[model samples]
Target: MNAFRTLATIVGGSLKNNATIECDDHGAEFFKVEINSSMDKAINHPDLTFLQGLSCRDSSSSTFGPLTLAQLSHFECGEVALSFCMLHKVGDACSAYYFLRDWARLTRDPKSTLSPPYFAMDSLMPSPFDGPMVSPVVEPKMEGCIHQRFIFSESKINALKVLVVAESCWLSGRIEKLPHLFPNSITMMVLSFSGLTEDPMPILEMLPNLRNLDLFRAYEGKEIISDNNFSQLEFLHLTELEKLKRWLLGTNVMPLIKGLGIHNCPNLKEIPQRMKDVELLKRNYNKW
Candidate 1:
């Protein structure tokens, strides 16, 4: 165990409530650090207590993404302090769990003898899925389409949260939309962790059984649905997405997407023929 790290392991069933990290883009990686000034006085704070009770694995990656350093620090103050770190999902899950556990053990008792966990990335990769890879066929469209982007305002976000909590608590709507609320920000988490009532708007229909999503670019800044299966998506949204190349990896998802649209995607260079072929609708692209 390394005394240099943060927090002690709260073993047994208690761990079930602790945040055990996971990522949708198992390929993506980030770490969180929380500092408690007094060795024995930080972990008992309400946020850490809530964090102790909440399951990190059960929470959405989007919500987990925006944990600020201050929040992390505040949660670890006043007894039972913690320094939390979440690694990417690209490698073994057990390795991450025990690594943190060992760190906690060391932090809790510096004299406790424990072998440190090793991280070797190369050894973790396995032979490919042992399946045939699909080929991509794309007929690019003209680049005259308008690209738009937008972000929900605080009021809009709060309103969404209220609607979601009401619906989740009421046991309404399909089970799928629940995951949409969990993003890096606390606000996103509030909205995502709750239920979404049915909306008369077409957007509700677009969210059916959808597992993964991205807000990279929209044609008119309107939310677009990409008709891809959530089950097989390896990557959801790529940063700085101006255009899509050949839809290669998750082609199997085409039929399962409940809703698919692209608007206000300013940099989206080429449009796929299949997407444009569908009955298309256009809406305003709100600015971020």
Candidate 2:
């Protein structure tokens, strides 16, 4: 069988046992895909950004099933981005990860054994916790949302590390001569080219004049950006970030933020309660 055929067969066979799956009125959503050629230079570049995504968009390019669909995007650079849009109602990360792992094993060998699903989630969820909770019902309509994949090239990621470290920050202020304290010559920052293993917040702290920030699939960090970071940021766009759980904002961080777009952040639990008391946000009339 060809790649597509094999892929379809394997996915179909496994969906039968997909626990808590959401079936649309149209039945199984199967899969939808498109091949992209526009990002050849970015994807094939020696330095590349990390992977991200899965959004339910009204556009024909995106597939919004009851909530699960797999999309494989092939670029002219011979790079492929396989993204799965799965709603929390149907399945959470645990189920999705298991499904993917099983799919890989089956793709490698049809006879691979499967891990049993643990149905006793009540033990972990308890009683009151299982009660109704607030869900993400509001979807912000963003006309300025940048749809292109963000690329943080190898050299750029390295530059971030070198320029943003604690040692560099201290040395620049001291008698030690450093190359311009900070790379202030570059004001605008974009991180979409490469998958980043290190957190870019430290680097961002050094760029006080940074006004526009576009981050795509860059930080899978648990705690993103220390307090007081992004003090001078105005326009910020974060898309498809996976592991961010909390937004650490201080008294004066993002004080001048005019527009902030957050898209496809599944695990971002909540904003720090302390931010509510920040006088700067109230003075600037900024609503997060």
Candidate 3:
């Protein structure tokens, strides 16, 4: 209780009730739970679900106010699991990461100095819409929800690529309208992890699922983008690869990239004439 009291003081700041929860009629409240259990048993429990098992908070019971909850479960094998539930009204993914990181840091070293969470965003955004907001804190019972997992081995991936490549027609789309939300996005870290040196064309030819690609520090000698590649990509970013001396873009390659960012590539020589037909050749033309 003493330790928790201190923790609540640290995390909750000056606000008494859960900070960001606002129900239609009610105001704000706090919820917390803690338990110690065998990690192996919990992991293998058939009926125990991920969300409820992790949270263990009675969110279904109306708190009569805004709600903030935390759950901590300690396993016998020295593994500790912690969960925090807060509304999107509170923060986004980056904020969640920082909160978890600092919380863990403080739990390890109670006296650790911490930087204040940035509330500067609060000032820029307009005042919250003046109306009753439906709180989705309590998850509704999901009916007919089937959860399944599949492992895609190297062989399976290659088979899928071969199947996609068999199509004789190449189709492309233009961006007449853009969506406000991007649910599927990929980053350049995927490229850096591949450890490919000669060219990045083969991977592009194989994978067609991505719509956004951010490739950073790719040390490939030449980036050869053929037409009919990256047909669905809308956003592209390349950065910090000196070895990238030439770029060949085919007319059918990347026909729909509306946002493009290139940085720190002193050796990059050329771009596609139409920015769609990308082709590469070595030249001392000092391509920017």
How does candidate 2 fare on TM-score? Answer: 0.32
State, as a TM-score between 0 and 1, how close model 3 is to the true structure: 0.32
Q: After TM-score superposition, what is the CA distance of residue 90 in candidate 1 from its true location, in Å?
A: 25
Q: Which lDDT tens digits does candidate 3 get at residues 1-288?
A: 333344344333322232333223222223343335566676677222133533323433334223334556555567767666544445566765776687788888888877766755655454457522233233545578788999899999999766544422221232222222322222221243233465655455434555556555544555645545676766665666666767776656766667666677787866555654333222222522
TM-score for all predictions? 0.24, 0.32, 0.32
lDDT to native, each model: 0.36, 0.52, 0.50
lDDT over C-alpha atoms for residue 48 of model 2:
28
- Displacement of residue 287 (Cα, Å) in model 3 is 23
**What is the full ranking by lDDT, best candidate first?**
2, 3, 1
Q: Candidate 3 at 192: error in angstroms?
A: 34
Of 2 and 3, the candidate ranking higher by lDDT: 2
- lDDT assessment of candidate 1: 0.36
